[model samples]
Target: MPVGLRDRIAAELTAVIHGGDLKLERYAGPPGDPGLFGIAPGDPVWRVHGQATGMLTGGFAALMLQSLHPLAMAGVDDHSDFRADPVGRLNGTVRFITTTTFGSSAAAREVIDLVRLIHTRVHGTTPDGRPYRADDPDLLTWVHTAEVRSFLAGHQSYAPRALRLTPAECDAYYRQVAPVAEALGAREVPRSSREVERYLARMRPGLRVTPAASDALLFLRRFGRTRQERLVVRPLMNASVGLLPDWARAELGIHRPAAVRSCWDLPVATAVGRTLEWGLGPSRIQAAARGRLAGARQG
Candidate 1:
């Protein structure tokens, strides 16, 4: 395809993945101060978290995993307008991730504080008469771990060759996200891939399907800003479902046939992933991140 067409396609893909939540304004102009995290442009995370494909697939998987937690699901179902305003919820999520990842220290802290306050207000009872609070440190840790793990897994599986991560790099990524997890009040967040796996394994006994989990899957597949978006994201969603842990896939009732898993999973994920990379080559967000890395190097 021509450059212009490719860019247009990439832009559309970006919009769909982000649910039109990407705000380039924050990243415009010459690179400013390093974000709160001070992540180097060359850091593996910059590549891992920077890829739109990984973020989308991993984010979807995280939500699926998170829904397994009854308390967490209760907090969301009771307090969130996710079903009523899916795009708005997505926008807020994207804003938080981008701000914390690329925003200056002050900006990042501001977003973190705001999120903490929101968490404080989100407390309720599960249908079974169990109390839940979003700010509970344990819950926070589950949410944080699930999200970061999904992001890393997606990147490992789908990121372009230039951005692929080694095992060391993956461990480095876990380290990279540790600060944000801590800032969010998540305790004992895993800092290595092995630790992450162990953490998930330990948590498995507590995970099971709930109505909210079922609803979450349906919501993700059916809601989008546009018909085209809903249609386009289906394959990515399928790929995401395949990426989930076997238990998670079974819980969601989205388990793929063994034939499909062996024959089609990797190729489909690769095609969608590479197309995303080609289309989303570089953008203002990355440029801003590069600028921060440069500034950090100078200082």
Candidate 2:
């Protein structure tokens, strides 16, 4: 069966969250102490980095399936923007926090809830002490759209699947996802077949860069190259990482120290260095991606 709009959007958003400009900001910071690799104490940057890493791993698919809690928190209210653009809003909140914190579905959900809570605390009250509905559609739509587009732009190079849909198919799928889109308040979900094809064509290159692969690239960029100029090179590295077989993880020391050094130059050159020395794990790619995207928007 042909990939539907939801699937394509999911894939594209995944790519953006991984290797896009958002990833660059979170992982492109200056290298930290090598000795602290795995054993390093928690730092704001590291926490965010870890979260980005998790997103690229298995958690991304789970998030897409709506099996994640943050999505559920948005509820199914049509009047709420969260319903229209659950993915987008979720992505925005995720992008703002530390990626390392999102190693599991539970962790990711906690971070997301926290973000919403914080935002509400900051902006959802009037001077008269009346609490505005935290579930406003306009706010939700803006937040989700910004985050989603940022993720897509960041991972533009990794998109692989073409948005090739027959006019009929495009119309049908659009209708399916339309409720969600409407809740998100997106202008429209590609009304015509021509528009659908064009959107798909634009998004194809990014689909190839899976979330996990994008996280790997960010990992390499942070620990390996260390040069600002090489930041743009991570998407390519991510593409390669996505293609690696699961069997290669052990042999390649994907979770080990020596791999870090071989992959990139930094204070810590080994996976052991990152884990034992700094307490950083290869998980949390997704959170980190979200953080980076949020940071970019802020910057």
Candidate 3:
């Protein structure tokens, strides 16, 4: 069977994370001196790794929604601006994923889920050698919460709309979400509105991240925007014959004459005609033929 989109994305992301391209040595300024102040200077490899991880994770979260709730996918896609801002997009996506499907526990449990998976892959052992459970402090829950909260606080300053609810309303929302949290074996769901605020506050201090990591994250924020633009343009150019749509093309003003020539001159019609002659279904065969033709030309 063909690989599902989620698995393919997960595999690619895992490879990127483990590729060793993102690692950076801690800079030593002078003997016993603190390194570069404010923003730590970062290596290009770190930047590339951070950017790739952000893109993959952001795309993965969006795809997860697409898998779980088709209607939510449209909401997510329509909010492309939110998606373009990596921090905002990620927080928004996580909130939507949890709240829509799981409610209040959504935020807490999803954080644990992502963290546990990442840790298990990276460390090669869970607490019991049976895979990390959601409650494990070092391996499972807290680490995930710290990472998610760090990402959110680092990138976003705006409060979620969910916070706009009145105390009573918020309490009701929490109550509604409590069952999901309970099912996940959360030690304690924030019982009241005040407890929720306090829970977040307590988690806040632990979310402090190193300057080098922050710089790495900032690089990812910028890289995601650039990739989004590239994705939009590549498809448009592939489908059309004439001048490309402005939205679909880069603004760098560097023209790729070779690519333009290849795209226009390629025997797309001949390839399609041959595939149709093979008695295969038109749509499926055309797609397969196009892929093969593209591969052959590249080879």
Candidate 4:
């Protein structure tokens, strides 16, 4: 296939995934500028995070898992219009990740500052009347870990061979992304897969399925801004459910046993994820990172 055709197809699919407002031509950052973490093109995080499959599936799984935390959910519930404007939230998230991962340091810091400012005002009570704040260091840690964990898992499960990270690379990815989590006020953030696992285990007791959490999952499962998007939700939701930890699966009432996972869930998730990755072609931010990398090597 022609590169133009492939890129066009990928961009269209990406727009649907991100709510149709994403235009690759508008994705901007200075060429040759390393972002806040100074992650290079060869970094494990660059390989893992650049995969569309892992990002979408992992992000979907993380949202479901994170909602189990009542305090975290409360902040989202009170402040976000996810129900009314799902794409806006998704676009914001995409911008944050892309900027941090591949934009200039100034761009990354700008997003971080914006998010921190937003966090200051995102405080509320859960339905059971417990207080919650987005910027609480502990809450920030949970959210950050969940996102990174899910992204890694999604990459492991969904990315094509060229994009997949080795075990060492995976750990490196965890380490690379940790600084941003800390900058976001996440304390004692996990920097490896094992540490992330241990943190989740320790956090289990505090996690529970509330009406708020359940409703959020349902909304996500059914989320789509367009007829085209609605068509793609089922397989993606299936993939998201499959990526979740067992504890999360139980909490969300998504039961796919080992046999089912191996036989059905994994394959479907892999296929859907890869399809998106292929359809979306190369991300503009990642292309910029590659350009920077090439220039540095030549210099």
- Displacement of the residue 243 alpha carbon in candidate 2, Å: 25
Across 45-82, the per-residue lDDT of candidate 3 in tens digits comes to 11211222222332332232122222222222332344
Per-residue alpha-carbon lDDT of model 1 for 1-45, expressed as tens digits? 689978798767656446554655454323457667766567877
- Candidate 1: C-alpha lDDT: 0.79
Best by TM-score: 4
**Weakest lDDT window of 10 consecutive positions for candidate 3:** 21-30
lDDT at 209, model 2? 33
Compared with the true structure, model 4 gives a TM-score of 0.90
Prediction 4 global C-alpha lDDT: 0.80
TM-score for all predictions?
A: 0.90, 0.25, 0.29, 0.90
TM for candidate 2 is: 0.25
lDDT of 2 by residue, 1-299 (tens): 23364455344444433332244333322233111112122322232123332223212222222211122223322123433443455455455433322222333344445655644433333333434444455445333432232222212212222422334543443343333334333454554435544653553332233333333333444432235323433433333333233333332334534455335422221221222212222334533434433443466
> Candidate 2: lDDT over CA atoms?
0.34
lDDT (tens digit, per residue) of candidate 4 on 112-149 = 99999999999988888788888999999999999989
Error of 2 at 153 (Å): 5.0
Task: Count backbone clashes in candidate 2.
Answer: 78
lDDT-better candidate, 1 vs 3: 1
Ranking by TM-score: 4, 1, 3, 2
What is candidate 4's CA lDDT for residue 263?
87
Off by over 4 Å in 4: 1-8, 17-31, 297-299
